[model samples]
Target: MSEAFTKSMARNIFFGGSLFFFLVFVGLTIHTTRELPERDHRENINEMVVLGKKVWEDNNCIGCHTLLGEGAYFAPELGNVYTRFGNSKEAIKGFIMSRPVNGIPGRRSMPQFNLTEEELEGIAEFLKWTSEVNTANWPPNIQG
Candidate 1:
């Protein structure tokens, strides 16, 4: 506590701290880059998956439902929906096709999008592809 404060000591401390953090940043960047290919399933992308994503965006499905815990929570979480629906693409398609256009009385219900058969299949394929991604157990529930 009796030591005098010096500019040289202060400059050294600042440089040391900056260098430590810079190295940590670089290390984390490298680690993330190396891990992305393993975590993201780019191999699963196809024409149907792309079309399905386009349909999802066109309808603004995220405005009501959450996907991978990112969207609004007004509806059920769809991050794990493929698994929740018993891993059946037909089941997903059926649910979308069965939505009531007028909605139920005094209850929240998904609106019918009047999707074509091709669009329905595309959406199902997209959901299936999304389910194959490595989320490390996101949602953490079977019912979501």
Candidate 2:
């Protein structure tokens, strides 16, 4: 009831706040651990998807495009590219094959990586798999 701000009062407040925040962090961690498995769509991952991921990494696709909102923002978000391309893997592959739209003054274009057919297929499959993941409506629109 004393008006004086004593050391004990400050210490108690610090410890209490730390405990509360620590508990909150623990709870959030547990919730995320439990929810991620259901949202990640890991069951659909296969050899093609794996290969696609390898191609993506090897080519540094993330250096330009953002996948599920994680990567550089120089290019479009490709998290839902499969859906945006009419849910067709072939369309995705065709677009990738026809890259680096040249002759446009000051227009940014995707560089052609000269990906092999198998790599193309794998990348398309991997993108398709990413599109199926439950991102809670990430990218916010069909344009992505």
User: Which sections of candidate 1 miss by over 4 Å?
Assistant: 2-5, 101-106
Clashing pairs in 1: none
TM-score of each: 0.88, 0.93
| lDDT string, candidate 2, 27-75, tens digits | 9999999999999989889999999999999999999999998999899
The candidate that wins on TM-score is: 2
- Residue 142 of model 2 has an lDDT of 95
Instruction: Give the candidate number with the greatest lDDT.
Output: 2
Q: What's the lDDT for all of these models?
A: 0.89, 0.95
Candidate 1, 70-114: lDDT as tens digits? 899888888789999999999999999988646457778798999
